[model samples]
Target chain A: MSAALHRIDTLAPRAEASGTHIAIAGLTKTYKTRGGSVPSLKPIDLNISKGEFVAIVGPSGCGKSTLLKLVAGLLPATTGTITIGGVKVTQPPDGVGMVFQSPVLLPWRTVRDNVLLQVEMRGRPVAAYREAAARLLHTAGLDGFEERFPWELSGGMQQRAAICRALVHDPEVLLMDEPFGALDAMTREKMNAELQRIWYETRKTVLLITHSIPEAVFLADRVVVMSSRPGSIEAVYDIDLPRPRDLSVMGEGRFVRYTQEIRKHFFAQGDLDH
Target chain B: MTDTLLVQSTRANVLSKLMSMDAIRPLILVAVILVGWDLAVRLLRIPPYLIPAPTLVIEQVIAQWPMLLRETMPTLTATLGGFALSALVGIPLAMLIASSKTVESYLYPLLVFSQSVPKIAVAPLFVVWFGFGVLPKIISAFLLGVFPVVVSTVLAFKSVDKEMIDLARSMRAGGLRTFIRIRLPHALPGIFSGLKVAITLAVVGAVVGEFVGSNSGIGYVLQVANGNFDLPLMFAALFVLSMMGVILFMALDAIEHFLIPWHASRRPDPNSGT
Candidate 1:
């Protein structure tokens, strides 16, 4: 590690080593569309540990993305509080990085420039993060593509670029909304493996929102399952798997067993308690 | 291997041949138009004073170059100057409108209503209000051009993927940062579309202003030509006006290509791959 990076790493209050990276308390979000006021997400509470890879999984339209958005402060909470690394998030909080399913890269910018977008917006000198960004891109297997445009790359390659862009600022927390949902099965699996490697390397707190049970099992230290629309957490499971997990591990009994367990919970019926 | 090389060369030759072949139909269309116009003038024995031949129109355009420039300058100034103003005012307004539903609700309907009224019919009113010379012409052109830009810009800003904004927020980007980094780039294509539509309309608006109450300009020249029954000069001025619109639109298209070459729509062809 460079002396400057070492200094930055120590100088900034350790976001991950702190007790919690993100804390959502009594969170609720309502949407007032022309159709009517639709409560997108009901009251919910979640706490994610520092440096942990947590995956939130639910059925489509069940508000997993909304939950993540609320945590990111992209959507204002109708009535609740969200704190990230000890800071209250009324608006978007700094030191948080994000990645989306579709890459969403600026078509005009080259890969390097796209990655530098965070710095540009923050009005930070690119020089401060250029080396770190280059290293992240290399780790993401995107070394030769710095000059390429998003359209020139494959779907997987663009997603890797998006991840690099998200992490270029060396953020404290990373929020991902089905970042690999658009890729083919094979590419998605490869990306899961790559993401695991990146998580191990950076130790940045990651909150991934995905619908795929297997993906959640493969990448996360903890899997958070949410209920249907007007969503809330149904269950949370600790993976207890070893790091540097191989693709072959995906075929192993332990991985399959965990995935099946999560799938069962996701589809389990709710009794008419009300 | 040798056979493969020969086949590839043959494919290249065939591709070039196909491109040239594609031009044939458009070329034929242009030839037919010219021949039809020439024949119609000759066979009908149309008086040059009423409907000049194509050759006479060209000759008059060239011979009256000084007069054309003198007449064209004011109109061009109004069209271009008003276009610049509209872009400046409309883009920021659209951004503001796009950012808030309340702004859009209040302003968008007003904008639509303003644009619905016939600009030509309102040109005399502008002349009455702003007076003749350049102010009325510029104001009329601005009024006509600004609407398309504002509408397209609003749509463009609205059309940005919500996921992208969430991604930025997850990365801890503030509203201004998100706007500058993500939303602005996404809105460029839309803004350019509006600009192109507005630019063409600007010329018509300038002419309308001139027609209503102008001491000088190509519209005034056209009026004089019509009054004197000089069809050649009228045809000449009309041709020049159309050329101006074409040139302006082409210029904007070129700018779009240069600025956002990675846009899928901007990609030339899969065959070129450049």
Candidate 2:
């Protein structure tokens, strides 16, 4: 465990020296309505290195989701810019996959076909990705159920299929907005383990947004907390946790301390979410 | 062993009896209604011209079977033609309305107003414009049917989860790709339900067109039967019309079953599978 912690200690400087995968420079977002302009995010800056996993946790309405949307290029930044893989992201970049809170699987599609939807929408030849989709579903423990529809699966299984869908295109970065928020506590833990395994194997840069302090600390290499509305990064903490951490690690002293530390922000804010 | 077998046999007997009752309940209700009508006519000595007995209606169905069958063709043709035309025009119009706010603002109010104008009152104008051929009846059907398709499809398109589109955008799926791959399929269930309502109205519209001018079809037959005081024949024609409406609705329902089998409404009960 100490050896793993030492590796994480070495990670930050090396990543900075090499160059960051995602760079946000003074990014802000404002939504215009008849009522007037409402600021969602303040001018925020963060750098995520290649193959790093970062999680952001904040109170409800804090605009952590808005930050993810800006990074995903689903919404334009009001001022400043976001760069991914050394290119300015004007629209959705070519190599990012996203998962929302709901599974959002096409009801008409079989589990495997839903995963292949990413490839199909991108104008890729679907036949070429068939094996890859099957392999990804297998990794999510959805083997032999490829022909099943979304309604046939439990909520947890549906979310797993969604995760598989996000990975099917072999993206360079994965963005998740409370992907497991709808799941039960027990199922959520299992999914966290599954996600960590997937991330460990793929080594893609990931940014996860969640309300659960334990979830954010359990999965992310660095945990960034944001303040309430018109959100800006409040603090950033290097997890200093071991790689390939299991669910039991959540009970460990370091993990509990991290969760406690993150939970303090939400408690102070008196948000309704908790 | 004998006691257990005896209990099992009795349980099976009760189950089978209950199953048969469920299957034949609707037929039993129909039988009671028909019997009551026949008895009322005979006991009151009512004239057949005023109200035909159920037996007389049955006799008319048997005696004029060939003529009824032939006249059914034209009415069927008009209904089918109008339904097809409604779908063809309405779907594209719905897509236009869904895609652009300007188009929606211009078209939606007009469409709603058109629905408020009764098809029966407007159908005579169609007969004058298109002549007494099947075309006028088809146009009448189209008028009645088109409204539901537009309204339902628009709702479906509007109701599509914004997050799903965000997911598509994050994948760099183009506008057309997102519409065809995501929005279109997602709207299909609501579109189909609209089509079902349109079909029922189309039947009424076609009959109204025949009432206005046509010399063929079941509508024409109904008019001729009324002139001659053929109450039994009128009832038979009404039966055929009701049956046609039911069959058309069921056919659309079956298509929905095949088209979107994974939809929540279509899927068999989770426990029913066992």
Best by DockQ: 2
Interface RMSD of each: 2.4, 1.1
Q: Which residue pairs show collisions in model 2?
A: none
A111-174: candidate 2 lDDT, tens digit per residue: 9999999999899999999999999999999998999988889999999999999999899999
True contacts kept of each: 0.79, 0.90
Q: For candidate 1, write residues A153-245 as lDDT tens digits.
A: 999999999899888888988989999888999999999989998888899989999988889988987888778877877777777678888
lDDT against the true structure, per candidate, is 0.83, 0.88
lDDT of 2: 0.88
Q: How many clashing residue pairs are found in candidate 2?
A: 0
Q: What is the lDDT of residue A150 in candidate 2?
A: 88
State the lDDT of candidate 1 residue by residue for B1-274, as single tens digits: 9999999998989866665674476667877887888899999998897678888998999998899988889999999988988899999999889889998899989888988998888888887898877988988889989999998999999998766776665555677888777788788889999999999989988888899999799889899989988898899999888888888888888899887666778766788533
**lDDT for residue B30 in candidate 1, whole number 0-100:** 70
